[model samples]
Target chain A: MNQLLFFAGLKEAAGTENVNMDLAGLTVEEVKKKVFEVYPSEQLQTSMVAVNEEFAGQEHKIEEGDTIAFLPPVSGG
Target chain B: MNGKQVWVTEEPLSPGEIISRVTRRDAGAINTFIGTVREFTKGKKTLYLHYEAYPAMAEKKLQQIADEIEKQWPGTTTVMAHRTGRLDITDIAVVIAVSTPHRDASYAASRYAIERIKEIVPIWKKEHWEDGEEWIGNQKETKPGVPTKEESR
Candidate 1:
């Protein structure tokens, strides 16, 4: 199972902190698209992604057991 | 040898402590920036703010900021501390300290550090207002007049 995590505003938008999915073989972009399909947010289209805690490109592949996060534009100062 | 000077603490951030971390006998000037939770933003009354982060990744990015500072200003040491959890109006949210042998480098490096943090750090903030609450994720948040998911219902 792959673990998906959410943070901050995304957490409320995701409605849960963690999710388990069988996302193996899917690219990061595909995984993100799936998330948006499930959560259905317009603002989410602009979200960035991270795989295994590192910022990942859209084309990066998601392997078995990889944790993914949809980071909605960061606002830290 | 260089040391890790970046930190994410739940306790209130102090510019003094951050400055002390980067201070050395060879340093001539120290520059500091403090981020505070203000009572108003764009005419809205902010009751408080809640900050959150993916701790491990947040720290890693902060370390990257420190490294970038050293690269840009040789002989400079930078330290930054960010606080999490709920904060009231006027609370200090973040403190950045940079020390160098000269004032110009110290000032420039300190300025660069804060902007870089805003651009790259994985931390986020949710602002509580009198009428409603808004999670400010990115710098380009839409106008305050828009309703949140809860409000839109």
Candidate 2:
């Protein structure tokens, strides 16, 4: 199982901080589609994906036990 | 050391404490940038702000920013602190301190730190207004003058 995390407005839209899924072998882009199907948001399109706390591109592969995060446009000072 | 001078805390941020972290005997100048919550934004009266972050990743990113500054301006030390949780109007939200052997480098590096933070840090702020609350930079946000999700609820 892989853990997916959300933050900022994405958290509010997803209604939770994290979710677990069996996502091994899936590409980051595929995982994003699954997420949008579950919790649809336009923000997901612009958000960056991070795997295991490091930035990952859409084609990056996901493995078991990986932790993925969806980050929206940051507004921190 | 990784992340020794970077922090993401729930407690109120203090510029003084952050500045002290970057102080050096060989440094001739120190530049500090303090970010405060404003009472109004885009003509809306803000009640308060709620900040959140992916703590582990945020600290990593902040340290990366500091490393970038050092590479760009050698002989510089940088410290940054960002406060999370609820913040009232005028409350200090973030502080960045950079010290270098010269004033020009200190000023430029300090500015670079803040800009990099906004770009890469895994931190965010939700603005609470009298009429509604919206996560700043949420692309799907309700347009101004329209009823917001919170307002309609």
Candidate models: Cα lDDT each: 0.80, 0.84
B135 Cα displacement, candidate 1 (Å): 0.5
Which candidate gets the maximum DockQ versus the true structure? 1
> What TM-score goes with each of the models?
0.89, 0.90
Name model 1 segments beyond 4 Å from true.
B1-4, B140-153
Model 1: lDDT to the true structure: 0.80
The sequence of per-residue lDDT tens digits that candidate 2 reaches over residues A1-77 is 99999998888888999999999999999999999999998878778888998777778899999999998877788
lDDT of 1 by residue, B1-153 (tens): 224588777887767766778889999999989999989788989999999988887888898888888988999988888889899999998899988999999889988888777767789999998788887865745332222332211
Backbone clash pairs for candidate 2 read none
Q: Give the per-residue lDDT of model 1 (tens digit) for A1-77.
A: 89988887778877898889989999877887888888887656776777887777767899998998777777877
- Residue pairs that clash (backbone atoms under 3 angstroms), model 1: none
For model 2, what is the error of residue A37's alpha carbon versus the real structure, in angstroms, after optimal superposition? 1.8
Model 2 per-residue lDDT at B104: 96
User: In DockQ, how does model 1 score against the reference complex?
Assistant: 0.47
Where does model 2 exceed 4 Å of error? Answer: B1-3, B138-153
- Residue A18 of model 2, lDDT score: 92
Among these predictions, the greatest TM-score belongs to: 2
